[model samples]
Target: MYSGLMSTPERLIESTRELLWERGYVGTSPKAIQQHAGAGQGSMYHHFTGKPDLALAAIRRTAEQMRATAEAVLGGTGPAYARIEAYVLRERDVLKGCPVGRLTMDPDVIADDELRAPVTETLDWLRERLAAIVEEGCAQGEFTPGLDPQQVASTVVATVQGGYVLARSAGSPAAFDTAVRGLLALLAAARTPASAPAAS
Candidate 1:
């Protein structure tokens, strides 16, 4: 059985994504990428001018993947809250942080707009999409009339991103879980009638 050949550029981009995830932008090197991808220096050079060029490609690919994931989670059947819960509760390596979120902390990656554009666009789009769903929920009477869709959407994203940062700093996944639980609780509270007294 043949494992089908991968072009040098494709291998390099895939390897770069892994390296970026594992070690970050500055931590990853061209040599390391070549070695990991099983491509020669010339092969890499033939396709990319340098690390930045390759990183751009890798970031774009990662962004596309993130968008697809969001669309799949937020654009499907079920209520907005349930779909959002599915998005957050779906299996993930919370300890590793979001691929898109991880890029935000990389100094080199964030410093270059060309490199960071995809990350920014991806996160912004996700938030907007979620906000639209929340707005829809409000209109459908699934959520409180006073609920602010934009605020809730931003909070949802913030909780996840901030949770990752906290998890990495604390060296445990507890922070991430707490964040998710807290967000869900807030959403649940919002679903109750305004006249209902808060649980003691």
Candidate 2:
């Protein structure tokens, strides 16, 4: 359910996003979208070409939202390690799993290049952004020298995505919390000691 103030098209897109997260592309029927959105079949057709078209819009919106959320913490003022820590520790629906990450598992979404672009692009962007942060951390001596920025970035992304799967599997948020704490511990170990020499 959505706000009454939202336009029909907005409601349709929001509904589709929720359905897509709840059910994969194949499981999310047009009728279900219309019913959830409180829009008539005619209204749905009038705003978008079809399910694919509407789904693409929903996916794009979700991707954009994800990027915005990450940027809020990653782009904030702080040492690089703290910023990265903030990102991982941010609140989320651990049991429900990631909204964008879930799409990666959807066969229908993965098969279509058009549908998959946003998902892939969003993930790629996240990795790149995190790499930049890690690189900055290395420069600031927040992390030890010789740590590969790109690799560390990928690891962070993998941990969060993998943590979601683990949490959902066990039906407990504790699994996700354990994964995050473990990563933080590893990162803390990687921190450069004040007495350590800078890379020549």
Candidate 3:
């Protein structure tokens, strides 16, 4: 079915995304990409300069997708805490981990500016967006007045990233769930108690 209508370039980029997720930049090679894409060496080279060029295109597309997915939950209609909760609690591939987050551990990716910029920018965007949500929660009196948005935002991001590490180490999703629950509990505790109901 895939070979039915997919253009040469589209097939190349899609294959690159999956390969990059499964194997870092170092592990992925032009031949591997070609094999995975079911494209010829000339077909691949015809559309792009080389592996790096194709990979950069793949990474940029991935970054945009990540932001769009996050925004769907973060920007949805809900109380701030609810939105934050939804953002974190959204179902994820615990074993596979985050596609973008996984790139941080890739030596080849980190060593190359072209490969790393999208990763950094995507994560930075995530942090800024989360911080803005926290700030909104605070403004609406859902959080303690003294809470720091950026710090809390960073904590949330760290918890998810760290959760991935623990899950992989333990060979189960329990670690990821535990970490998320723990973070949510902390967020709940940070909420300012609602004022007592009006007296008679």
Candidate 4:
């Protein structure tokens, strides 16, 4: 799934990332990675110490990509609620599920501290970033006072991850859309009235 121009190491990482997302850690074998990357076993070994090392690189790459994508929307100019909406409604492969979230379900990945670190860190960063936006929203009079930013952020993350599970189970994106719609509705309900004071 890579071009000839890509370096062997780059190809290996990219291939592993896709395989891990699709098949989880247990299913992704070194042979499969080499074959997918069109690299020889020698090339794979030359770049990485072993599967764990290669998997960590792939996981880190995926996590970095996820954060970059989220930051693009969350960091954009707009009301906090609007930015959150953009994040929740952002296009995704609902059926394939979250790349990082899937790792949390993989036994091998979770069992390995090094492999799991990126996944855990990525999710934690997401919650914190979202919590910051929520706190900003409250400050800007966009959301009602007394809303806990951290709680709200966790709910948002839960909804998206849960939505992916629901969508995958139903074999339809409708489940995901419904979950997002419900989240938006709740967020809308939490908005402060136009006449309300910012501090109120």
On residues 1-200, what C-alpha lDDT tens digit does candidate 1 reach at each position?
A: 11348777888999999899999998899999999998899999999999999999999999999889878878897887888888877777888889999999899988998999999999999899989989988888888788999999999999888988888889898888888888988897787464334579
Backbone clashes in candidate 4 total 0
lDDT of each: 0.87, 0.94, 0.90, 0.94
Work out candidate 2's RMSD over C-alphas: 3.5
Candidate ordering by TM-score (highest first): 4, 2, 3, 1
Residue-by-residue lDDT tens digits, candidate 3, 78-178: 77788888988998999898999999999988989989999999999999999999999889888889999999999999999999999999999999999
lDDT of 4: 0.94
TM-score of each: 0.91, 0.96, 0.95, 0.96
Evaluate model 4: give its TM-score: 0.96
Of the two candidates 1 and 3, the one with more favorable lDDT, higher being better, is 3
Model 2: lDDT of residue 70: 98
**Candidate 1, pairs of clashing residues:** none
lDDT of 2 by residue, 112-191 (tens): 99999999999999999999998988888778889999998999999999999999999999999999889988887788
Against the true structure, candidate 3 reaches a TM-score of 0.95
- Looking at model 4, the pairs that clash are none
Query: What's the lDDT for candidate 2?
Result: 0.94
